[model samples]
Target: MQGVEFAKDLIQKEIRGLELLFQSLDEDEKFNEALQVMSNVKGKVIVTAVGKSGHVGKKIAASLASTGTPSFFIHSTEGVHGDLGMVEQEDVVIMISNSGETLEVLNLLPTLKKIGVTTISITRDKESTLAQASDIALSYTYEEEADHLNLAPTTSSTICLVIGDALACALSNKKDFTKEDFHLYHPGGSLGRNLST
Candidate 1:
């Protein structure tokens, strides 16, 4: 395979997915609801997922925390094995699942409901079980995956990361987060150096 040719196709697919995601967000009022939950939460934002979504979830949690939202990530499997203790009734939990029916993610809902936390689910299926179960559902549909095989999580995870960034930015705006607040949480990196100066 010509590497450049393959890369161009993949890049085009990713761009297309982002376009669709943007359109979906414009039409979805639930995005605003999720933002309200994150903005008003007196507790940390807890993000959970498994597999590729888990990796994306970690970044989402980190972005939220650094932007002054106070957040963290927990593997759904571990949440079941006692990590859920870290979550609180006041916390807002966000779950990521490409298919929206991931068993590991779904398995946590019953307990989360009992714990009385506000739950949000990000998935491609708005009507999925996980979406239906959560208090707020953020869903988007991408036409296809980036690779020729069309079997990887590339586009899906990219879109999820973008969604997380949007949420973090929204909350940051709502809270009037400034460079000073950002420096407080991110004081050791080049980004911190730039913000501090």
Candidate 2:
């Protein structure tokens, strides 16, 4: 019970800090632009990330595709090998990193730049190299003492996942995606029933 409470406390503190980060943005234009990008996507939304963010990216990509926007996730490390070919000129790339300086993600930047694909950065650092390179930067702010587990990525990753969900749902609303579209992406079992006509 104590452990669960501690974990819950950590999550709350970190998430609140993240909310503070978004609040400090002082501009919604970047977010709005991202919305427009998703809405205008001629191909698909390409999400890339490494480590923990990669797991969240996968879920986010799935959510985006299932909701309204067509999206898919590609591991950052694998991108250089061959996954970069998965992206189309018409697609928008969303890169996830807590520090906004992931090497694998950074290495792919040059190619993306050459290809002229719009890139969005979802990270805690607005001044990070990845953020600087991104066409749109959605920065996450964290409070001073929010136990980051050796300042690794525990809290930040959780907060980023929440933000990703918010983006997905907001765009879903904007696109007016029907539940029918959801079932098409999720043809599993009971949950599928909820989305089916």
Stretches of candidate 2 off by over 4 Å are 1-5, 144-150
Tens digit per residue, CA lDDT, model 2, 34-133: 8888788798899999998999999999888888788999999999998899887889999998888889999999999888889999987889999999
Per-candidate total of colliding backbone pairs: 0, 0
lDDT of 1 by residue, 79-150 (tens): 999999999999999999999999999999989999999999999999899999999999999999998889
Candidate 1 global lDDT: 0.94
How far residue 27's Cα lies from its native spot in candidate 2, in Å, is 3.9
Error of 2 at 9 (Å): 2.5
List pairs with backbone clashes in candidate 1. Answer: none
Question: What are the Cα lDDT values of the candidates?
Answer: 0.94, 0.84
